[model samples]
Target: MIELSEVMLEMKDIIKDFPGVRALDHVNLKAYKGEVLALVGENGAGKSTLMKVLSGVHPASTHEGEIYIKGERKKFANTKEAESAGVAIIHQELNLIPGMSVAENIFLDRQYTNGPSINWGKLYNETEKVLARLNIYDIEPTDLIKDLTVGKQQMIEIAKALSLNAEILVLDEPTSALTDSEVDELFRVINELKEQGVCMVFISHKMEEIEQIADRVAVLRDGKSIGDITKIEDITLDGIITRMVGDEVDEMFPKEKFERGEKTLEVRDLEVDHPLREGEKKVKGVSFEAYKGEILGIAGLMGSGRTELVSGIFGAYPDDTHGEVYIRGDKVEINSPEEAVEHGIGLIPEDRKEIGLLLTRNVVDNVSAASLSKFSTMGVMNEQEERKNTREYVDQLSIKTPSIDANVATLSGGNQQKVVIGKWLTTDPDILILDEPTRGIDVGAKVEIHRLMNKLVEQGVTVIMISSELPEVLGMSDRVLVMCEGEAVATLDRAEATKEKVMEYASGNF
Candidate 1:
């Protein structure tokens, strides 16, 4: 017995369409004051679309719906209007100016002022108060946004929302970048906000988080609401997943064992210098071998240089890096990413939003970005050839989009990741390196990516994966390479790589 009068936000019969696709079809959602409503869905399941509608990123006219806030119907033409109505959204990709200080970002565009002058003292004081409220003490008001860690940046985003006096907060995949302890701290803050009667719509793929934080859950599937909202107590993980995916996901990671072949990629005495800091080494003398027909997992705590090591091998690092890399028993000098591509190497970067896709471009452009030479004639792109190539990958990767011309920004996180993979596959690399391939994607897409990796191995593409999720590493890899403090500490076979063992090595227990 829930009461609708107590609801802080209500969306009824929402319908949104984009070109040839119906992104949301008659979706209904509600969020009560002092409660966290979890949104669960598969890739392209309309969860993001629904949130965009609520935030006014997709205005009322673009989406068919009735939006009620505090029992009063209202229409927002833009995000500013939504903010004026006490709504704020923090996207999966953070929105913070790197050069600005923490306090400046928190009070951006609405800085405290006195007669045409910014009130610096008041801003710092208010920023400190907000930090204290969140139990964060290390971050200074003057600290640059770029200097803080991802977790701290997320806190700043929350603080910014609070500064705007947001009563209804929408968080999309907030915990994807946080560590275990940071996640606990964030959960504490969320609980505090709940007590303050701030309605929150939490979107995440992590089941444990949903169970711990959400008061109610809504499931979306294929651009439609699957059913009515339900309590967390009434559903199991499988049950929620079934509703979101419209089928039973018997196994989250469908890994198949394959016999290891001859060594394909071997790195010895690898050292990557820090790009920004002089005389600082990000990766130091790291050595490992990835065999063909197998997935070699790189396990590490964040900032342990796992990404740097792989980037060095893929020639994404600067020329100052010192490394010895061999492919199929032949040493190669990879001074640039182009050279790496020429030597049958491909890398999917860790920060997908920054390094992976062209947000303004279409799916076809992003998928064919890595192999544009094939579609070029006399230094000019051949549109017909480009479309043919893009269509091939669009079908092969099962990318769900209205058309290849649709902007990549319109797709969900999972589908965006698939586009990244498709871009790399176009290069036809023998050795593929994936850094956090499934970081922010949904569980269904995670399994699909894992299956795709296995399929690639069957086709003899060597796969080296770096992952923070211990379960994924243990479940998908034939061997795990544990890195700690910029060095490879231990290499264990799949049979020997338990979570405890991997964590021990990753944490420098040995």
Candidate 2:
């Protein structure tokens, strides 16, 4: 029988330092069998650094640390060695190969082979059994991962970890990409894993999810452990936030209203057909208007076409869209993002890593990507102007980086998001569309972005935001547009909108 009280994994006096920065300083953490340990921290607070050290991404010699598994001290030279010792990390950015089948990704490196060739039938059968064990019936073993939704892709990631026979699972912000129902399903699977004596480490920014799923909570701040591990019931959300940030944040959502101006953008009879499905429309006659000096919010559940509607207007899906988009009452033809930008429209996409920033490029390149025309003379980019423009926006947006030339991949999630925003701001668009702008960022950054939105409105720029976070929608927008299925079902003024009411409209309750 598995001993639930026994510590499955332990880290002692771990110290990891990067160039010019000590990322983790004497951090200690432990995970017991059958318990979910929640790790909480601000961006760059060393939570991920500590986990990377344990997973051998930093190796033992690179960091000062002692790792014990099952009461035996062990040293891992690489990620493969750590995995062989039963440690698996499911990262925030999924590590699945999109073109491969779900079954292939699950048994990736270790295939069921016959004479050094894969046995397809046995692979499919084993994959089906793993899916059955997880009570996931919707996904087929042979379906390509690219065809699956983000939620299903995450499940495939979990299944891959299980295939490794991982005794210690490190889930880094697993539900950041999931819908409400998907989140519930993931929680159920985590519970099942706990019952099977799997020691799990969960890192998340959502306080409610931490309270719901974590058995114990540990807080990290400024590369140091702020306090010892404590039971979930003993710590409040305020307590956790205080320890994570080392400051009192009185309100999570701060709203500042401003006077409205003339209409800056107007969309009429906007319709978009499904790209893959013929004669099927994803957005149906969606009409809305945004004025200068006001933030308009779009609220909807998953698969409600909120993103499609915005993308279509931004000319991201011109091949399958039909819409009358007007900027400052002048009808515009925006068949591509270039045309949209020429018409003074900017979009901060929902998936920042995928669509917003060039991950391998430096911060200067990303911030100046959209507005290269401003720095070009006679069809050649002026390096001086480009660097000057990038520096200006970096300062304006408060982007944290060692220098403007740092690779975007090295920055934390929040800082990456700020760079994306700065990229759009450099375009000098009169209108901006932000989809899930604050999805994975920390609370401090969220507030900063909210304040920036207000500042933009004050500067006479119209803002349209789509978010699943209800508090953000209510607190930031002057008006809320509720979408369901493929249409705009309700538009409520800020004074009239409530969480329950918007949810009812979003869920088709009314």
Show pairs that collide, candidate 1. Answer: none
- Which regions of candidate 2 are displaced past 4 Å? 1-4, 98-101, 113-129, 137-147, 380-382
RMSD of each: 2.8, 2.6
The ten-residue window of minimal lDDT in model 1 covers: 1-10
Q: In model 2, state the lDDT of residue 341.
A: 93
* lDDT tens readout by residue for model 1, 269-340: 999998899998899899889999999999999888899898888787758678788999999899889999
On TM-score, the candidate that comes out on top is 2
Every candidate's lDDT? 0.89, 0.90
Estimated TM-score for each candidate: 0.91, 0.93
What lDDT tens digits, residue by residue, belong to model 2 across residues 1-510? 234488999999999888889998999888899999999888899988898888989899899979998888989899998998999999989999999999999999889999978999999999998888788999999999999988889889888988888999999999998899889989999999999889999999888899899999988888998889988889898888888878887777667778889988998989999888888888999998999988999999988999999999989988888979888888988999988898989999999999999999999899998988888988998998889888887888888899999999999888999999999998998999999999887767777898899889888889999998888899899999999989999999999999999999999999
Location of the lowest summed lDDT over 10 successive residues in candidate 2: 1-10
Best-performing candidate as measured by lDDT: 2
lDDT of 1: 0.89
